[model samples]
Target: MKLSKRLQQVAELVPEGAVLADIGSDHAYLPVYLVEQGRIRQAVAGELNQGPYESAQRTVREAGLSHLIEVRKGDGLAVLGAGEASAVAICGMGGGTIVDILSAGRDKLAGVQCLILQPMTDSDRLRKWLHDNGWRIAAEELVVDEGILYEIVQAEPGDERYKDSLWYEIGSVDLLKHHPLFPQKVSAAIKKIGRVLQNLRKSQGGLAAQKREALLQKKKRLEEVLKSCKQR
Candidate 1:
C-alpha cells in the first residue's frame, strides 16, 4: 500500500516494532503499509464513522492482514485498551479535535510511548495543548503533499521541562529550515496568520484586543524565522 507523503513521514516517526493504533484511520493504509514493511507487528485501525470503518476492514482483509491489523469502530482512543499500543497516530484532523481526543482518552494512553499527530489546522493551539498537558514534542517535520503543506509532530510522554517560545509561532524552524519546501511553507503560514491579525485588529472588544496582541507576537516571531530562512 502506498501512503501519502504526509502519512509516510508520520509512519517513519513511529518507533520500530511498535504496536500502533492509528486513530481516524480512513482506509487503514498507514498500518497496512507499516505491517507489510515489517516495521510493526500489530496495529489497531480505529475509525469513527461506519463507511470508513468498513473501508478500513476491507483494506486489512484485502491485504491479508486481518489477523495482525484489527479494524475497530469507535471514537477517538475509546477503541484502544490501556497498554495495548506503544504508539498512537492521529492524523488529518484539526488540532483542536486531536487535543479533545487525547484529553478525553487520557487514561488510554498509559502505555503509549509516542503520539504522531498531523493537525489539519490550529496547529499552534495543539502545540500549546501538548506543552500544557505534559507532553513534549520530540521531533517535528513538514511535508508538502499534493500541493498542501502538512506539519507532523512526534510527541512523547514527558514533563514540561522543554521550552521553545517559537514552537507555536514558526514550528521547528531550526530543524526544518533547510528543507526544500520550508521557505514556501513558512511564507504561507505567515500570510495566513497575518490575515488573522488583520481581522482581530478590526474587531472591538477586550477579547479582540487580547487576541490581536497574541497574534502580533506570533507574527513577529514568524517574521524573524522567515528572515533567518532567507539569510540561509
Candidate 2:
C-alpha cells in the first residue's frame, strides 16, 4: 500500500513498539504500514462509516496483518478503552472535530502517551484545544503532498505549557524550525493574511475595522516568526 507523503510522515512519528489506535482510519493504511514495518506492536483501526470500516477490514486482511491490526467499526475513541493503546493517530479530519473526539473521550486517553493529529482545517483550534486540555505539543511537522500542505502535530497530555496567544495562530517554534516546508507554509499563511486584510479594508462595518486591525497584528507577528525561522 503506497501512502501519501503526509501519511507516511505521520506514521514515522509513531514510536517503535507502541500500540496505536487510528481514529477515522479510512482504508486502515497507516496501521497496516506501521505493523508491517515493525514500528508498532499492535494497532486498531477505528471507523464510523460502513464503507470505510469494511474497506479497512479488507485492507488489513489483504496486507496479511489481520493478526496484528484490528478493524473496529465505531465513532472516534469509543471503540477502545483506556490502556489499550499507547498512541493515537487522528488524521484527515478538521481540527475542531479532532478536538471534539478527544474531548469526548478524555477518560479513554488516560493511558495514551502520545497523540498524532493531522487536521484538514481549523488547525489553530486543534492547537488551542490541546493546550487547554493539558496536552503539550511535543513536535510538529509540515508536509506538502500533491500541492496540499498538511500539518502533523504530536502532543502528549501534560503541563508542557504554551502561551494562549500563540496557541491558536502559530504552532511550536521548535517544530516549525525543523519543518521541511516551513518557508512555503509561512509564505502561504502570509498570502492568506494579506488577502483577509485586503477584504477587511474594503468592507464597511463597525466590526470590520476591529477585525482588520487584529488580523494585521497577527500578520506582523507571523512575519517576525518567519524571519526568525529564516535566520536559523
In the range 130-232, model 2's lDDT, one tens digit per residue, is 8878898888988888989889999987886565475465677766766657877877888999998877777998789889888888888888878887877
Clash tally for model 1:
0
Largest TM-score belongs to which candidate? 2
Off by over 4 Å in 1: 161-164, 196-217
TM-scores vs. true structure, each candidate = 0.89, 0.95
**Candidate 1 C-alpha lDDT tens digits along 1-232:** 9988999999999999999999999999999999999999899999999999999999999999999999999999999999999999999999999999999999999999999999999888888888888888788888889988898989998875336666675566656778777788778878988888877766999988888888788777778877888888
lDDT of every predicted structure (CA atoms): 0.89, 0.88
Off by over 4 Å in 2: none
How much is the lDDT of residue 133 in candidate 2? 87
CA shift of 86, model 2, Å: 0.8
Count clashing residue pairs per candidate. 0, 0
